[model samples]
Target chain A: MVQINAPMVGKVLSVDVKPGDQVKKNDVVLTLEAMKMQIKVYAPADGKVVEVNANAGDVVNTDTVLVTLE
Target chain B: MDQLWEIFGGIGIVHLTPGHVVMWLIAFILFYLAIKKGVEPLLLLPIGFGVFAANFPLTGLTEEGGLFYIFYHYGIETELIPPLIFLGLGAMTDFGPVIANPKTLLLGAAAQLGVYAAFFGALLMGYNVAQAACIGIIGGADGPTSIFLSANLAPEMLGAVSVAAYSYMALVPIIIPPIAKLLTTKQERAMVMTQMRMVSKTEKIIFPVLASVIIILLVPKSAPLIAMFMLGNLFMESGAVERLTNVSRNELMNIVTILLGLGVGSTMTAETFLTWKTIGVFVMGVVAFAFATASGVLIAKLMNLFTKNKVNPLIGAAGVSAVPMAARVVHNMGAEANPQNYLLMHAMGPNVAGVIGTAVAAGAFISAIL
Candidate 1:
């Protein structure tokens, strides 16, 4: 299992990955925004995106999961 | 013998009086304003219901062992509720607009003048320092913040302070316009603004972290409020933290609001609420808010004299923490002046800035007094 971690404290401005996107390590899978700034969430080890945990405009705390990778 | 017989019959006995009825009517009016007029109903509903419940004859709703008593003892007495509310508030706020255009903080700063002004006004009206402080907080126009201050400073005037606070908040839509119009000329209101730079995703992410440090370090008392707001904004901006944001903005905010609303309303009772002092507080509150709004617009116009790029003075109205309401008002008013003007997005810069400013001003007041 691959874990998606919050790169920063922010709201999920947009989710780039759906339930079934194949991703490589360090691929941008989600976008997070804080203070009007946006950031992309990167994938960990190479994996297929199994489930996305957040939709766009959801607030995320530190170290929260953004997706499930298998 | 006749009085005793009538009292014993339980027929001539009325526990609630005309004054209590007036309070209940006021509470219902609040409900109507919230439901029909869209004034902070999330809070007005619980507060209104609590008022009605407490005002009902012989209910003991706020007495010992009552649920409201329990809530008051647990939170309001210790000043826990306001700070906790600030936490959820922090989690829900978007500080980017304020950060992108840091100058709007001054509008928020200007609005706080009402608070201090009310302080002096109340003192002259014969209230001691503590009572005057409670009365002054009505200018802040935040229910919890006002309740928190009154709970700390003057427990005697809780009902009056709470009513005045919420009442003025409801009146914001009506109260701000005349002041807004008076402060800015037709030319100032019709002025166009340079489009704000589309803040990058990276800048948005850094805002909360950077601001928490800058603001909290400057005003430690504001840590709870400013920190919480920035944290909420962080959650909203963080791509990875969806669940937390949803919880903070929705479930968490909703639940706390219910408790806060009712708990605050319980403070109002016939004995505590019906007084000439309450009237004084309400009047002073309106004057304070009007002064605050006028100060903001006038200051913006003052700034307009120097800037190469013109700014719509209407954005100054966003300095109040009523959130999107004041911001929306700025947008509408700007459109009224010029149909082609698109000020909503531009006004948001000061709109969100006002949130932070009000919290800071509250922090400053809490710091100075307590």
Candidate 2:
């Protein structure tokens, strides 16, 4: 299991993946909005998403677990 | 009957002039822009109200010992509020991008070409040097710096210059895109910049101090704004002064913004604001913004010629110091050209640097003129 953590402080703009969905390394898993700019968060490795911890409009801090992948 | 006539004569409407009515129209336009259009409402709303109140004849609101007069006199004329605004700005700003990529500082500096362009333009239009200097700073796209410089150099032109600076800043999205497009090819706009290196906490904490020392040393006249700015940044980056940081960026910022806006707005009396020069300020302001945007883009292209890592020339337009707005514009432009390109973070380096660049420019003007 691997946990995908937020790269920085921002509000989650969207979560692109769900549990049981497959993602390739570097695939955008979510979008975060900070400083009025939207940043795409990429998957670190190939994985099947197991749990999503944040929702659109949720403010997240750096290192907050955003998704758990198996 | 004579007493009744005297009472009627003392009424505000009896004192109204055509110029006062014109000022009211201008104030209403500001109101429409602030409330209906939601453009820069925080400052414009109070400024609009200030304009409205000041225009009412016999109110004494902008006279000696009046509320707005006090705000303008102690807050702006004394050179207090703009620096305080910079304090809050510094606290809110994150200099990580600038620390990670110092080269963007040049992009910030290059944008100043617009300042000189406007300065020369203003001089050609027959404004005295001080007034031209104040007008030139409108190109910096920094409201506080423009206010600071105008208050110091040309208090008479403060209303025109501040209005121009903030109006143009809110119009960054509209102003930057065409200029950026005109200069860069589709391929240059589409270039993807790599992620900036992570900046350590030590680097962040040290940056404000080093920058303050260096910048103030270089431009001693800038010490007021730069010192407070770096101090506010220190509060944020030190990790031990979170409380101070919070207040500086939030409550203090809000309080000062109201005072600053109202003070600036109150200065827009019909006698002061309704002038051929006010129109000239608006014209030169747009010219300054366009030149600043073009110069930033051109400098980025110039830097590309020598650098190994190709920078998306779109990020250059972010060097006008409109904070996240300019950066967001660059990011959106980059995304439109190439979906994979995320220039937001890369643009931030120049965005923040532009703030410093503008302060230094204002300081240089002050040093040379005053």
Candidate 3:
């Protein structure tokens, strides 16, 4: 399993993938908003999401695990 | 009867002039605009109260050893508050769009034509070179930059220049649209720009340091404003100094803005603001903005003539230093032309670039004049 961490301090605006969903490399898995800017966290590699750790509207810090992929 | 007249004699009524009452009315109008019209309340509110406070008969508020005096001396005349405000603005800005499209820097540079145009206009109107340069910067549409230049080059005209700059900034929504629509066709307005690439974290982190080094090396006169601005951007992009970013963007920004506005407003004595030159300053300011908007759009059209990729000329109008407000005006105009179009992100490139470009232009004027 691989963990995906939040890259910046921001509110999680959306979770685009859930457990059992497939994502391609570079596909946006979640969106975060910081300093009124939208930041998209992309999938590092082709994978199936195994866990989702954050919800929309959750304020997150850098490196907080946001999802897990298998 | 003699006692009653004598009792009131020592009060301020005898010394008050019609000009003082008119100044009071102007202050109240500013208050009404801030509260009711929501026209840059953050700035207009403090400025309105400062004008009212300064006009209290024989208060000395605008004289030596007074509150407004200290604010103007320590904060504005010393050139401290404007740079601090730039720091906050830098922290709040996202330079990703600018990084994504480097060509938009031209739009920023193009918008500066307004400043030069206004400079010549002021000069023709018989203002000295220093005063004309200060008046011209009102075209930059950045209040702090206008104030900074005015304080340094032509301290006497600071009141008129600052008022024109801020008032035009607040009027961006109303002023930019008509000019933008008049300049572009429906096809040009609806031109859909491609999405900007995702800028990497390394690039984001390096930008401020790199920009500071380059800009300062080229125009050392702009060092104070540019240095603080880059430092704030670095703090945000580094992500290691979250507290610094928060404070820079929030508390520090708010405090500096209040002091800055009050300091500027206190300079507006009836003797300064009531002149025919003041009217000329305001008139030239509109001309500057109109020309700035036109030039941005025209430049975009010119660039499209040379490039395969077409840009929406509307984004050119966003090249003024009003930041997101100017960008939003561009976006709305694009949307009006085509509902599916999203030009906000693209317009932001020139919007932020205008901030840097304005600073550079101010530096050029400073270097040339003084």
Candidate 4:
């Protein structure tokens, strides 16, 4: 399983991915906010979502684990 | 007229030639643009004041031991001004995003095409290589970077180059959009980018060091600017240096910005500033900036052709170093292209990287000149 990582230091605005949901290589798993704007987190490769690690209102920084892909 | 000339000549400071007075008015107009138009006022206000003070007959500000004169001579002429500006800039930048997305570094480098293109363009116009490189750095929209290079390469044109860089920075909002629109279509603008991966705090904290090490090794001349910028980012991310970071960003940055602006303004003495070269430098600045923005977008468009992932060409325009302002402009334009499109975060990668890229280019220019 490959893990999706957070790309910046910011608060989690929301999670777009869910556990056990089929996802594409570039599908956004979550939105992270920083510098007064939000950025989406994309899957690194094509996979089926196996687990979600973070949720809404989470404060995240770079390399924070967001999702695990099977 | 003889008596007036004699009285002013006794000052041995300001020549008060007719050309000098015209330059003073020109300097005032620059300040007016800063204050009224809300363009890069941090530097422009003091620069304007400096010009006004320097131009008045017998002010004694720029003379040896004279206070403003001392400010100019000690700081700018001696090359202390640009580094101090870097100190403040280091305090002001946040490197979290760039560290999180290291690939964006490529975008930053891509944006520097403007600098190279303008450099050659200047050469075509009869400027020597050093002078052309100095003028080319204007596209980076980074003040200290431009000043640092110009001081080393083309000190004779320092005033014009500095003014051109700062003025174009203020004009980033105005200059980038048309070029972006002209080069890109609506579908290309509306294109959404995959979200960036989260950058860990540990990674964030280590990023400045790692980036500085890597970047400095690749471009040694960029060390001063890059090192200082990385130091500021370190202070911001270290958490242990909260007080230092706060002071650096707020008090240090604000104070230096004021002095730096004024000191730079002093360079705009009427006699040297108002000339055909001033017009040439200004035109060169716009060309440099335009080319830089266009190059970024065009590179993205070209890359999109090979990649099916669909790169948004609009993000390329953010590759210049104007920071969030240029990124925000991209966001606004992207939304205009398609209401559902949000390019802000994606735009930021290039925007922040542009800052570092321009600084590196400045470093490269200094090296070539030296």
Candidate 5:
């Protein structure tokens, strides 16, 4: 399993996928808000999402695991 | 007949001096640069004409009751036009890039080294402390800030300093690339930054207010420039104020630009602009700009040493307050180094920060000297 990390510290504005969903590289998995800007976090590779860690409205920090892809 | 000769002697044709002819030639060169070479035509065209009009002996265009006299007195001397120009600039600016990557603000601060370099150079050239401060601000590569500083500290050198600042700003494309290239390597130039995180609307709405409140509290002297700039930004970000935003960026900006140019140009009488000291200001102005660009790049490189993520050093060159022009140069240079590399969005972080940095530097100079 490959763990996808949050890029910056921010509140999760939205989550785009769930466990078992497939994502291609660069496809946005979630949106985060920090410093008054929304940041789109993208999938790092073509994979099936095996686990989802964070949900919408959750506060996250840099490198916090957001998803596990297999 | 002797009485007739004396009476006619007061006519403009009889009063024409060598200085008037020399100033006319200089004005023609400004016209050629603006119209043909296409260097900052919006301001340069009106300024060139103002110079010509002011030089035509006894036209009173620059005197108390003259046409341009109003522009000089109300627009420049009273410090009305520059802050208005800042309003337009703010409405046109997008702070998304700077807000997304806040660390780039340091690159903006780094570029102020140019202002200090020129300040000392001007002092060494025998300009007084006030005059040197005005001359040093030319390195900021921002017209309004340079004008604001000169109006307060060295009104006599306003014409020379304004011309130097605008001319160097227009030459940002030519001046920055060589220095940027010399300081960076191919691999460094090819370094692509990560994709920027998107900024939210709520964040956008908050930025202008927060910036004004914080920056003003830090430097009250910058209130005029910063306050107007934030007001314009607020007009744009509010979404409810489209009409005001459109007018500030368009009609108001155009009119103020014309008056500002004319007012600045009219100050260039032969008595003020033709002196040896004017030449020294020009020399120091270029020195300041070059140093500012170099310092930005060097600071970026220095930052790279400590940070895990490598930044393309060219963006640092955009720290000189020429806005997108300097940023575009960095983008083009990055493309030259690597075809797929696009640094425009990233370079903007430092580009806009340079504007704030220049304003802050101007405030420091104002508080210290004035």
Candidate 6:
């Protein structure tokens, strides 16, 4: 299992995947808005998304786990 | 009957002229753009009101001892408000990007080519060098710098130049994209840059002091804006002056913004704003933005020739000092080309550097021309 943390403090613009959704390495799983720019969060490795800890409009920090992959 | 006529004669309606009516229309346009279109409402709303009030003849709003006259005289003419605005800006800015990638500083400096381009453009159009310099700084896309430089070199052109600067800044989204598209190929725009190294708190804290010493030492005339700017940044980065940082970026900033807006707007009287020279300023303003945008992209591509880690040339458009607006524009363009590309942090380096670059350019102009 692996937890995908936010890269910085930002608002979750969207979560592109949900529980059980498969993602390829470097595939965008979520988008975060910070400093008035949209930043995509990509998967570090091929995995199945096990959980989404955030939603659109949710403000997040660097330690906040945005997704759990297995 | 004569007494009644005398009373009526004293009212603004009796003193209104076609020029005053035209100015009212211009003010309404500013209001619509601010309230309706949501374009730079912070400055434009107050400036629009200032235009509306100042045009009301016999009100004395812009006359000596009047309200706006006081705002203009003590706030802008005295060179107080713009520097205060810089204080707030510095407090709010995060220099982590620039510190992580110092080479982006050159992109910021290269963007100043637009300033010089517009300077010569203004001169060729027959403005005196002082007025030309004021017009040239409009390309810097910094409202306060434009106001500061114009207030010193060409107080007469203050209204037109500031309005031009801020208006163009708000239009960064519209202006940058087409020019950025025109300058770079799709492949270059799609280049993905690696994540920048993390900057330390110690580096952030020392940056303002070191930058202040170097910039002020090089351009002594830039001391006013640069001094207050670095001081405000110190208040933020010290981690011990949250109160001062909060006030500098918030309360004090709000107070000064109102004064700055009204002060700039009060200068937009019918006599000063409605002229052929004012038209020239608007024309040269767009030229400056285009040139600045093009030069930044070109320089980035030029730098790519010698560097090992290639830069996405589209980030160069972010060097126009429109803050996150230009950076966001670059990010969007990058995303459109390659979804995995995150150019915001990368673009921010040049974006913030552009602010410093523009200030230094203003300082240089003051040193050479003043």
lDDT of 1 by residue, B1-370 (tens): 8887677646423554897888888889878978998777887888888888888765666889888887777768777777767666666666656666667777666667767777888899998888887777676666667777777778878777876777677677788888898777777777767645546678888988897898888777777667777777788887678888788877877787788788878888778888888788888888767766776777777877887666788887766656666666776677577643556556666666666666676667678778
Q: Score the docking of each candidate (DockQ).
A: 0.02, 0.26, 0.06, 0.10, 0.04, 0.42
Q: Pick the candidate with the highest DockQ.
A: 6
Give each model a TM-score.
0.77, 0.91, 0.84, 0.81, 0.84, 0.94
How far residue B216's Cα lies from its native spot in candidate 6, in Å, is 0.4
Better of 2 and 5 by DockQ: 2
Docking class of 4: incorrect
Q: Output the lDDT of residue B140, model 5.
A: 88
Comparison by DockQ, 1 against 5, better one? 5
Off by over 4 Å in 6: A1-14, A24-28, A42-47, A50-70, B1-7
How far residue B165's Cα lies from its native spot in candidate 1, in Å, is 2.6
What number of backbone clashes does candidate 6 have, counting pairs of residues 3 or more apart or in separate chains? 0
Clashing pairs in 6: none
lDDT of 6: 0.92
Positional deviation of residue B154's Cα in model 4 after best superposition, in angstroms: 1.3
lDDT of 6 by residue, B1-370 (tens): 8998887988878889999999989999999999999999999999888888898888888999999999999999999999998999999889998998898999998899999999999999999999999999999899999999999999999999998999999999999999999999998898988767878899999999999999999999999998999899989988899999999999999999999888888899999899999999999999999999999999999999999988899988899999989998998898788766778878998999999999999999988997
Evaluated on CA atoms against the true complex, candidate 6 attains a DockQ of 0.42
lDDT (CA) per prediction: 0.73, 0.91, 0.87, 0.78, 0.88, 0.92
Clashing pairs for model 2 are none
Give per-residue CA lDDT, model 4, range B98-150, as digits (tens): 66555566677788999999999999988898889988999887888887787
Worst 10 residues of 1 chain B by lDDT: B7-16
On lDDT, the leading prediction is 6
Q: Compared with the true structure, what per-residue lDDT tens digits does model 5 show for residues B132-189?
A: 9988888889999999989988899899999999999999988998999899999999
The fraction of reference interface contacts (C-alpha pairs within 8 A across chains A and B) present in each candidate is: 0.00, 0.18, 0.00, 0.09, 0.00, 0.36
Chain B of candidate 6 versus the native chain B: what TM-score? 0.98
Please state the interface RMSD for every predicted structure, separated by commas: 14.6, 4.0, 9.2, 6.7, 7.9, 2.8
lDDT of 2 at B7: 82
